[model samples]
Target: MQSLGPLRPRSTVLVKRPWLTKPFNWRALSSIPPSDYSNQSRGGLPRFFSETLPSSKGGVIRVQGDEFWHMTKVLRLKTDDRVELFNGKGGLVEGFIQNIDRSSIDFVALEDPKLVLPQTPQWHIFAAFGSLKGGRADWLVEKCTELGASSVTPLLTQRSSTISDNRVERLQRVILAAAKQCQRLHEMKLNHPMKIDNLIPLVAKSKQSFIAIAEGTPLVSALTSTTKESSGLIIVGPEGDFTEKEVDLITEAGATAVGLGPHRLRVETATIAILATLTLWSGSQQISNC
Candidate 1:
């Protein structure tokens, strides 16, 4: 266990303004042309698709579904158009459109596939959050993927909102879109919804785990003091926060009860804050060691 010393209060004032009040750069906005595959930069901003195949020299792969539609009908790409392909299993290949048809497009690998290894120590944030309403869960998934959470699991807590199977599917799609935008070679794993009690034993065995609470140790202190080889889970409560019994169960199970700051953060805000803090803390620790 690590000591967080004393908790302190922090505050900031935010101002809101209308977008129309700001000066507009109409020319700068107008200068941007419509997106076309031909004008796509070479080795820069290449469109990404997920099609796993042999990475051997000159291997051919096929692109279909929404990806094929976007490349052909939407972007109007034709033969010889270059694109980047990843399998979300550490494979990244540079390929070019070899042929386009009514249903699919063929791609010819132009170079040997490159493997993007996971970060050192391979820290994984197993975010077990309650089901959020509307787009909140979707936003959380997208941001978590960008923040490099290895996996995210929706927790079924006593106070958690209802999460349908279809919602899980939608969240998975959000993860995929975010991964493509972030150019992540390895996709973030979105696990099925699980009971919070089921997560207790796993937390006890985790290399490191923290539960975000309002009146606990400061997260920064606990994280900075951790060993460089540490990697584990983070659990966040839902709207109205977790029940007292749930809190006791997690704390007793060996998870450190941590706090972001003085303010009570919304579920999505807290999720982002926790992930962002851990990411920065890990990166900074690595740099200092070097």
Candidate 2:
């Protein structure tokens, strides 16, 4: 009742105090504009591989070795930055950098990771190509992953060139790099080199399979008309292509021989062409059904 400036009107006091009528806009208090972090909020950010990335959130993931050098030296990412992570086994997570060091990086998972389903139904490519001369094998692995091949088996056919053990290791590195670059959650499986005869049984088990041959039914026709199976395999032969006896063996194993084009393709070229053809055909079929 002590006259406070003649009771300066309760309504005026409420109007002057914004908190009385409106809630605080916390987002507007951010120092960095919303657009500054737009890329980090989306799924198309640069990805890194951590074989041990946890499916659930709250664990710290360590990035070491060449990946560390890449993030620190090349990309120059710093603390508190965000990155996309994959485990090369269908696990994908968005992580926030917690710490960095000379040899490694530690990031904390912010939320539950996502599992990316393969684009194609478990399609395997039993590529029996010869040991490519230069960097062709590396290129083949990279392109094959982008084209949606689930796995690639190197076949040591009768006509294949000599492949050193180091070559396979190098090719595995290429597969990993390619998978990360293409944002493929599942890394394409790279099998040890095996003889052509040893691969027939694997082909026989596929629900639908094809062998890329120079003179056979058109690939598109075969793929388009085939029953949609859960699993399939495509066999690609060496540089000189599979011999008559080898062809007979594969045919007997139930793989339909399909032709890619009129002209013969090199081992790498043919591998990509066959895989690309199948990927497109399968995608079209899915869209039509949708």
Candidate 3:
């Protein structure tokens, strides 16, 4: 009688034990301890830097660039030491020294690291600055990247002193170092050097653009409203400033020439002032959304 009828299929639902479900929820389902999730939930700064990288492919990385020299020679790090690492690609990891030799050292990746995204301002600043000599342009690029310039373009103007274009790699190194120091996950871009006449007409065609000229137009009057797609390009000139012909050309090309401040500034100083103003403007716009 028991074997006469066909057996019905059993349900595939298995009850999970309390302990099993609890650990799985805490570790697999959710990240970090529930009590400490306040900051993590709100997307605050990550606790660890480059030191907590996991052993997975691409999760953990090593920087053989000047960073290696800085780590070994400058910082005098040795085996068993720990450090945090970040690749400009938004990957952060914590790593420990596995071995230390004369030339290079191995850092063992430990835990799965959390990637921290940079809160880059909504707007982008393309600083087309006239060339400066004696590493002044290099300094300009470094500070600009630090202050949140999305990109930079070196301008070979009528008044420029330095025309040698051999410092691109050096400028990139400075940008990378600045990004790392500032905890900025976004990479700063450095475009090729171009003549002011050529770049202005090309850029002036954009929907959102402005040129910073310390005398022609008032700064406050230019930024009357901040729309979602608000952006501007600041043109900083050499010691003697942009040639009148160049200014005329840009003005004819539909670029809104704006001033920075009451006092005329050096090229480097002017670039920083413009960048600071733009950064503040971007912040004000972001807060206005609330």
| Top candidate (TM-score) | 2
Which candidate order results from sorting by lDDT in descending order?
2, 1, 3
lDDT of each: 0.66, 0.68, 0.55
Tens-digit per-residue lDDT, 90-176, candidate 3: 455556767666655555556554444444453334344444657777788777766766667676777674434446666766776
Q: On a 0 to 100 scale, what is the lDDT of residue 35 in model 2?
A: 32
Find the candidate with the highest lDDT and give its number. 2
> 1-290, model 1: which lDDT tens digit per residue?
21112111111111122222434222222121212211322336465656453344466666777777778887788899888876665566678988887878777777666654453323344344545667888999888877767777776778885567667767777877787776555667776666777888887787777888899788878776776433677788877788899999988998888998899998889888877777676652221110
Tens digits of per-residue lDDT, candidate 2, 1-290, equal: 01111111011000113112434232332132223332332454567877655434665656787677777898898998888877665566778878887677877778666654434445677776546778888888888776657677777778886457677777777877777765566667776666777777777776778888889899878867787664577788887888999999999998999997788788888878877666666653221110
* lDDT, residue 63, model 3: 40
TM-score of each: 0.78, 0.79, 0.69
RMSD of 1: 15.8
